[model samples]
Target chain A: MATRQYSFYPGCSSQKGASSSNYLTSVQAMCEELDIQLNDIPDWNCCAASIGYAGGGELPRLTLSARNIALSEEHNPGQEIVATCAACWLSTREAAERLHEDQSLLAEANQALAEAGLKLKNETPIKHMVEALIEDIGYDALGAKVKKPLEGIKIAGYVGCQTNRPFGIDGESYENPRYLDKLVETMGADSVPDYEKKVQCCGGALAFSEPEKSQEMVKGIIEAAYDHGADMIVTPCPVCQMNVEVYQDQINQTYGTKFKMPVVYYSTLMAVAYGRSAKDAALNGQVIPAKKLEAIAAK
Target chain B: MGDLNQAMIEKYRTNFLKEVEANVEEGEWVKMCMQCGVCSGSCPLGKFWDHPPQELFMMIRAGKRDEVLSSDSMWMCTSCYNCVVRCPRELPITHIMHGLAHYAKRLGLVPESQPTAAFAQMFWDNLMQKGRVNELKLGLKLYFMNGFGDGIKVALKHQKIGMGMLKTGRMSPMEAFGGHAVKDLKGFQSMIKKAQELEDQRIAEHGA
Candidate 1:
């Protein structure tokens, strides 16, 4: 098979935190096995997240997103821009759609980019790395690479709000959604029943904007997962992982509850299926201990 | 003055909850509150409120309109929706808080205990005017409007963060008057007009 290449944009959380670090290595190894070259974009900037630039006009936000896309279009040919972070996935995907839908805004944003010695034509398509692996590469192919099947493990999949809500590609829903869960099942694990808050926000920046209020939102999601008896949470978004993990202590203290649900990146979980070391996936750095997971792997 | 049936009010409770969800994310979960004490017990702020989760729901269920409207607990809810998360039935207690808060404000109840409401108004104002929120200006306005000098002190402590935003061309307070965000100023004006009209109607219908 010809080696397919992709330009991956690891958003801020991936750079600043350990979750993405663990995920990227495992994803890279999987890409290698699948004959895909997952390369990072040079000098990439933050996606400003989906909500961060809500105060700025569309142009500034669009311009910021387009600048990153422009680099991918200019430097790489044919490959889509693969965003590992949900915020980046949504922002970059919106950049492509919005640039086409609102021409006048696109013109203004391009002019701003021009001053910075860059141009954006929205030539490259923005795709989530998961989309590439599952949709483009095919799950059967991914399944073939799994050396150690995740049998008897029940996994709950969380697709943060941005990837599937407010605005996203068609055929996505909060009710009985099974794409990520199927991916988990394909790796030989049982996908747990869907819970109410699976697609909810992990409080994201709102947690910082209103700390006390944000803690409630976080606690609420954790409580829902607890209700479902989920052993771990597998998500593709780093901000969700960051928010859900960082606030575990606060949520535990406030709710008088003991929720030890581990949050694993989908890529990290897939890496485990690939028979790669948990350490290679940086599993130990998780806020919710995956000791059971580690023990299972040990056997 | 006529007596409203309890079932009739409960039937429309879903609609009221939906309205709160529209302003929030994961709003559907609000209607699922099972009256489980998990939310009350789990709530960090429950002990402080006179009308805790159970009481608030009971009042709503019984159509104890006067009691729910009169209480200060409604305004104190931070819209955290923690109750919804832990509620065995998933009642959107957070949305309830927001709806009741709005209703209280509309009824001319505790008109001053509405910092978050003012924050919402200012948020929409900025959005209507500039097509975005300018946190620097909004923060200052919110601080003064809330009459909390301590918030100003806290904000000032984060001056370096604000300066970095300015340096990055992200914190242009001057844009509040005229900038890319307010390019089509007319659209913003119309939005503000619509908001004011809505507020006026609310006050007329629900104001004391």
Candidate 2:
């Protein structure tokens, strides 16, 4: 068994019964089954999500994320920091890059860290769990682990904003990211090639604040998935899943349509394909339950 | 246009571009925008903004302080960074919009009844208080902060989502009633306090 180990940063969303708990649970199960050792960083704080960007100046937001980077450095020096939540991945990666680029900001952030007796080197590689899976564990090795190869289940690969914007996965087009599609295909599922809203924003943190606008964005994404004959939409971000899934009923009421599309994590599919049971994958926690996926896993 | 209004425009001293660049970290990068319409065009919500990104930058440069700050344009920015990646000048357009929103909030210029601005403030408050946000608390605070009637109306509308959250184990009963907070509250508070102090010191240097 090949062992891949790294510092795991589970953001606030990973707390018990939070929006991203299932994503965290499913990803953790998938990682364990795949032989990746994730050492959880002790006492990790919130990533300051979009609200940090919304209400505060740059230094405080950078400082908040820098503290996490500093902790990973202390606990698991030189090891890559892996995050399942897209917001956390974006926050940590963006902070490190900004600090690295601006010496003054780096000094300021470090000074704030000095108060906590921590100083960030900003050297640890921060990545989304998807990037680690694609780069570190190639799909062929992952493909070999599929005990129940997904068959006849058409999945729309929704790569939301953070994974590929500003800093994208290796060889990914910022405008049209295909890494998710390829992963779906490698898992023995049909990838919707012409999914237009694949790289579109699912209205991030604004889903709570501006419901009307966010619902429209979610409609565009989900409607496209349904229009393309997809049984389910698989994503890498927990926020996307929540925003996309939670808004469907309201969206349906508003638009006079019947769209109950299941928004699930890519790890959910990977776990099922890798021979993990549906319950272990946390599939039951899915908001709009995916009957097709569950039946395939059962087969 | 320059000949007719030069005196009138210059006399008002409405030019806020310099102040924004000096004071706001994200706003500093907006000075590089070359009036390329790419940002406006790339935005999903661009059509909704009264002043699209290109126009907003132009107005900012032209010293339209009241018009720029009071406009709903910044409030509507979803921070998708579509413009950030496509910008020829490498300007962080999304961040600039967000910075402008923060500036408006600081000045009490955000239009009343703007939920996004309200939600942003609530979100920050929760994070600052508990060191991390509890979803239920954040949700309740957001809907109810305005008034009881408004809260119930919004709650009734979103009840399905709430029930679904409970059903799926995504939100536990305890979490729904009372949400989770950071374990090491002291450490979290201190880090936030230190960051706030450093940020305040920097902002003060900008001469308010």
Candidate 3:
């Protein structure tokens, strides 16, 4: 297949040395295998993430994402803007949608953009990486390139919030998004189609601000995965992956329940299944080692 | 800040719902809620909140301004958007929750020692400096937010995770000095300033 191109927005979490930097690494490797080109939008700023709302207000929050969209429109021209971070995709897409609906807001946003020597035409389409993987690169094509199928691994596809709600991928039910499970099946793993907490919330940014409440929510997510008899959990959002994986030790200590579930990205799974090395797949980034996938990669 | 708060109270009188409609982002949607309670039921953290989304909407309509504004319930929203999609009235419940939080912050009515509000301010301040977040500084600030003594305790508790992150190269100590930034820092700051000013102007006009 011909190489498809997209303007990539790697948000704050996926930056070098950031929480999800390994996500960026694995995505780069996976994209190369899939014959896709990701061009970085020059000097993209923060999406002002969901947590920023309290201080960022409305217009400032919208402008932050608008600035990135404007930069992509200017530099990458016709390519659609793709964000691997779920928050970035949601923020940027919300900005684009709101701007298009409100002409006055668009005018005001352009007024702010003008300070940065830019203008937002509000014409670009913002998408999450999973949308691109499922729509642009179909499951059949993705499955065809899997050099080493993960045969024995039992996987629970965690479609946590942001990507699953408000505006889910094309034709996906909010209650049950099957794209992640389908991707798992394509990689020849046992997909737990009925993972009860598949669309549950991992408490997003609140994991840092309200640890007790957020950890309670995270406990439910990880506990459900274990109940499903899954070897590991896979997710698309960096926040979901981080919250569910990193808090297990603390949760175990607090709740007196030992949990050691490895929460990894869909890109990491694809990279390993495509016969990439553990380093190439950035598997070392997992706080709880994905020992199962690591063993698969060792093969 | 208190002056704006006082002036807003006098301006809106007892009509709290109308005041919210004029001030909050997507505040007008609050009136659209039919009290189906799906948003409250759908929220994963609803049980922990003092006032769930449905109760908050009810309170708003009941003209419980001081109680609603000072409540910490809205800060519990993780932006999971479950409430948004499940709202039978399509109230944009998530945005309304955030809008209420922002409005309370603007009026300086956020509950005292609210962790979410405090962290949001720290994050905004950090981002404004370099156009991107210096995660190291922000994390350090969060740890020390309560006091030096408390900060030390929290830091020690999470030291293992920090070391693990550093060992895996997921975080860098060098970032504490100077983190990533947009190339046109001046322009970015000015654009943000312009947006804030415009928002203030819009709010002023609405008040007028």
Candidate 4:
């Protein structure tokens, strides 16, 4: 598609030194190899994530995201707003959908925007970066860009909650979405398709609030990957990566299970598949040492 | 405990479903819920709730206003949309959960002891301050919110992950101390102020 360009919404997670900084850095490196250009939207605000839903009113949630949308529209014009974070994708997309569906809500959001001299026409479609690769660049084309396919590594694709339910990738099943599995296959890696916790909730940021239950859920997810003999669990969301990897020690201490499963961004795998350096893929950002991927990349 | 039971059986209490549908954002969808256990079954923290999601919806319907609002079920939803996707009725069960949470929170029904609710409020406060969230500040604030002694214990507990984050360059003290997350802080705050103004007016109009 002549080097497709997208308006990038890094959200808060991708900010410098945040949890998903490596995820963003690696995604960008992968995009470069795949001939995709990500244009950063100027002064984009937060995606108003679960906070908007969990604490604030509906209009406030819509308004908060609408400001970002209005800015994206002004900065990038009519280009699609592609969010790297799954929470950003869901909430921003939800705001866009809400604004589009209700005229009164649209008017109200616009009113909120009018004060800041920004208004959303509600035209741009919000997409997750994974969807863009599968839909815009196709798996065949994506594989064609791969200079070094992950041949022997067994990757269990964990779609988590955001990327699958509500607004899933095109042609992906809700019960057993294989887009991540398919992406892994396209990169010439062995995908653990039978991995049971592919769509299980990673408990989101509940790990911070209700750590015990969330850690158990994380245990189920990581252990399922191990059960299927996956070398690493690859996910699209940074929050999932943070919860999956960061909470492992806590889970181990509480549950008395010794787990050393490595959770990595799909972009890290994608970047490596495209022959980007392991360093460029930010493999060091993971809480667990990515020894398997490091060994794979060395060979 | 006796007073709580008395409040639950009181007929003069608020019509919970009516309040939800009238005021809560996505609460109108609660009526479409078929009492199917899909939402409750799909919830990862299903057993943790005083009343599981399906039963809570029924509670809301039966005008168990005090009981439904006071339950931890709303606060327990992690914003994972498992039930929303699996719902045969296509009801947005996740948003409904959020709506109920917001409704309960707005009315001060949620207990002061709820950590999840406290974290969520801190999340909102963080975002409102900077139009962004800072993990370092957030973690510290969350800890201190629980009292200093407990916060220290929690910090000590998480030191391993904290060290991992530091070594991996995911958490930087420089960014924590000096970074400005919102590029145009003044402009962003003005934008938020306007949004809140509209929201305040909207709620006042509804007398909610």
Candidate 5:
């Protein structure tokens, strides 16, 4: 295990908005506890996200994502880059996939990069931190690390479009799937089935594109989740977590629905379930009320 | 020389309900229709319609094409897929329903009470011209063609949304034509034509 480690890219949101950024501090603490070293790439930039390219063509999006990939390469060659933010994960994956698929495009992108004093060969594999954990570390072994084991609490997992779309990662299907729920169960909880609006986007770009539309979509998702009896929504992506949580107050007000859906990282949840203290995992920044979670945990 | 029972409606009895293409996942979707009537019960337009969802599936399988296509239920769907998710079997009911709607439109079997077919044609028109969907333009075009009241107000509201979208870089005017772009468009058209041909062949066989 000590023989391999990748440079981690936190992306823009991790540096600013998301609770998962603070969660990173706890993750670092946990990594220390687990004796794993994850080096952060220096002078890293944004992945430009899925929203940036929703209207724009491949050039701008690919260029933006490739710059970060280039930075990772400069810091640590011949090693993979692990991304915490879902948008970053998608962008990086897109860059890598696009660069690999079209040689001419790759040459052009590199030529554009040369102007910026950067080079991207498209060789590195960008893995979502969860993928690295579940695929690389294996579930049963991680299960051995669980000290608290969140037993009997009901949790529903939400993996937004970015984490699963554009289709390269091959472990699960985006629709009607059970992997995230299974991941939650691995942490020792019942994964509730809420099929309503499961595939609907939380309107990530719509927050910028059409704020009202964004609000409507957010309200719809929360209502659907609540109707299905999800005590809390656990997501692997930070944007999904942020949109679902930050907009909850707005959504509740707009739609007249009581939505107390706590958005949490699957890793943080696992860390807590395994008996790590809240400080040990940093669950404080979570948008969902911490006390409610404590009550669920205590039971 | 089989004796026909006067009480049994042969047309109704011919419907397997279970065998309908809509009932694709018989074990899952078929088993889950609790008949609690939440589907028919909760439907917003259920009271005004003659064939409820349960009956629609039955009609499709029974070859009661007239009843299924002529109903207002398909028009009122909104393509929300709410019923699909709520259904115990997860039958992709909305997808199946939309296919039936499209088939009805192509055959001119659609009722005048619903104009969903007109909407479909407008969507194609936008796609063919622009290579993408422009909801604002499409909506206005639709409203005008159908003589919908309050076109200006409706158009203005959507235009505001469209303007907002444009500002956010979520919606934009078509980009300047790039090298090899026309080739890509031609390839896409060919793919679409192949898909339509396949669909038409299937409908022909099924209708036969």
Candidate 6:
């Protein structure tokens, strides 16, 4: 297979020693197996994240992402910019879309960018890494590369919000996105295709600000996964992975329920299925360890 | 802040909806809502909210300016985009929610003790410092946001997780000194400053 290259934008969460640093690790491992080269956009800044609108307003928020897009255009020209973080992808893509649609906003954004020795061309295609995986590398090819099929494992594909709604993966329904399920099935796992809360919200950044409300939402997601008789849960978004995995202890205490389900990323699952070691798959990063997946990696 | 708030009230008079449409991002779409309750129903945190998205839009049209801006309902939005995709009228409900929240903050009407609003400010300050967020400082700041006593309790509660992350190299204590920064820090800060000035100017011109 020929090598595919993309300018990678690992957002704040995926930065070294940040919340989703493990995600970056597993993603790097997965890309190595898939023969994809991710060139880092030199000295990239935050995409203003989802909660940024409250402080950044519209134009500044747009400019923050526009700066990154401008830097990518200048440095990694002609390559599609891909983000591993869902919020990063959403904010950047939304900025590009809004800038393209509104020429006046584009001009204002460029005025800000000009101060930073940058310009908002709004020319590059912004994509989530999962979109690149599904569209660029089809399911058949992905499945063909699986060295060790994940047989006998019942996995529930949790297609949480951000990745599913607004601009979802190509040809996917907002409510019932089956791409995650298909990815699970391709890895030879028993996918719970009808996981009820697949598109449910894990409360995103509110997990820090309003723990009670966000935890309630997280409880629903994990409870639904357990109800489906699945051994583990998988998601593409960093916030989903962190919220669901790290909050189990608190949820168990708050709800008086014994919930210890391992919320792994789809990349982690793919890395393990592709015969990568547990370390390579970043299994140790899980707050609630996926013992079953770790055992699979050991095998 | 109070002067600007009062001026806006006097300008818009009894038309809160028009005020929002003129100033808020994607606020123009609020009129197309058609009173559909799908957005309210689709919200994961709808039950916890004092007024859901539908009710908020209704209140806006009713010209209940003080109640709408100080309600604290918009801050509850998680930006899940559930309401956006599910809205029958295709209202960009999520953006409107954030827009309302941002407008409220700008007018100095954010409800007292609003944690999300506080955290957003902290996150923004942290980001603008180095053009990137220092996770360690942000986490520490969040823990201590309420008070020293509350900060201690919350820090103690999450100590295990923090230690685990540190051990696994997912977080660094050294970041407290000075975390990663964009190479062109001068240019970045200047750009952000210029954008803020432009935005303020635009809002002032619109009000005038």
- lDDT against the true structure, each candidate: 0.60, 0.82, 0.91, 0.82, 0.57, 0.91
Where is the poorest 10-residue window by lDDT in model 1 chain A?
Answer: A50-59
Candidate 3 residue-wise lDDT at A260: 92
Q: Which structure is stronger by lDDT: 2 or 6?
A: 6
Strongest candidate by DockQ: 3
**Predicted structure 4: clash tally:** 0
Per-residue lDDT over B8-69 for candidate 2, one digit per residue giving the tens place of the 0 to 100 score: 23443565787778655577776788887999899987778899989988888888877887
Q: Which candidate, 2 or 5, has the higher DockQ?
A: 2
What would the TM-scores of all predictions be?
Answer: 0.60, 0.94, 0.98, 0.95, 0.57, 0.98
Better of 1 and 4 by TM-score: 4
Q: List-wise, what DockQ does each model earn? A: 0.04, 0.57, 0.83, 0.63, 0.02, 0.79
- Write the residue-wise lDDT of candidate 1 on A122-221 in tens digits: 8787888877877787778888888888877777787766555433434555334567787888888877657667766565544444556667767777
TM-score between candidate 3 and the true structure: 0.98
Write model 5 residue lDDT over A1-299, tens digit each, in one string: 66448788866445322224555755665565455568777655445454332122344346656766887788788778888777677668867886787786576666556655678877788887777776777778767776666776677777656566534235766565565777788888778665556555675543433346567767776676677777777777765776677666556667787777776777677767766666555566654555545653454
lDDT of 4 by residue, A1-299 (tens): 63799998898878887878999889988988877888888888777687555566788778878988888899899799899899999999998988888899888888778877888888998899999988888989988988887888898999899988789999888889999889899988999988999988878878788888888888999898988888889999988899888888788888888888888888999888888777888987877978877876676
Ten contiguous residues minimizing lDDT sum, candidate 6 chain A: A47-56
For candidate 4, the docking band is medium
Q: Which residue pairs collide in model 6, if any?
A: none
- lDDT-wise, the better of 1 and 3 is 3
Indicate the fraction of true inter-chain contacts that candidate 5 also forms.
0.00
Pitting candidate 4 against candidate 5, the one with the higher lDDT is 4
Encode model 6's per-residue lDDT on B1-208: one tens digit a residue. 7877888988899789999999999999989988879988889989888999999999999998989999888998898998998898899989999999999999899989999999988888899999998889999999999899999999999898797678767888888988888999999999999888889888887676
Chain B TM-score (each prediction, in order)? 0.60, 0.86, 0.97, 0.88, 0.63, 0.98
- Greater TM-score among 4 and 6 belongs to 6
Q: What would the per-residue lDDT of candidate 5 be over residues B152-197, giving only the tens digit for each residue?
A: 6555544644453344233334422321111234433343343344
What DockQ was computed for model 5? Answer: 0.02
Candidates 2 and 3 compared by DockQ, better number? 3
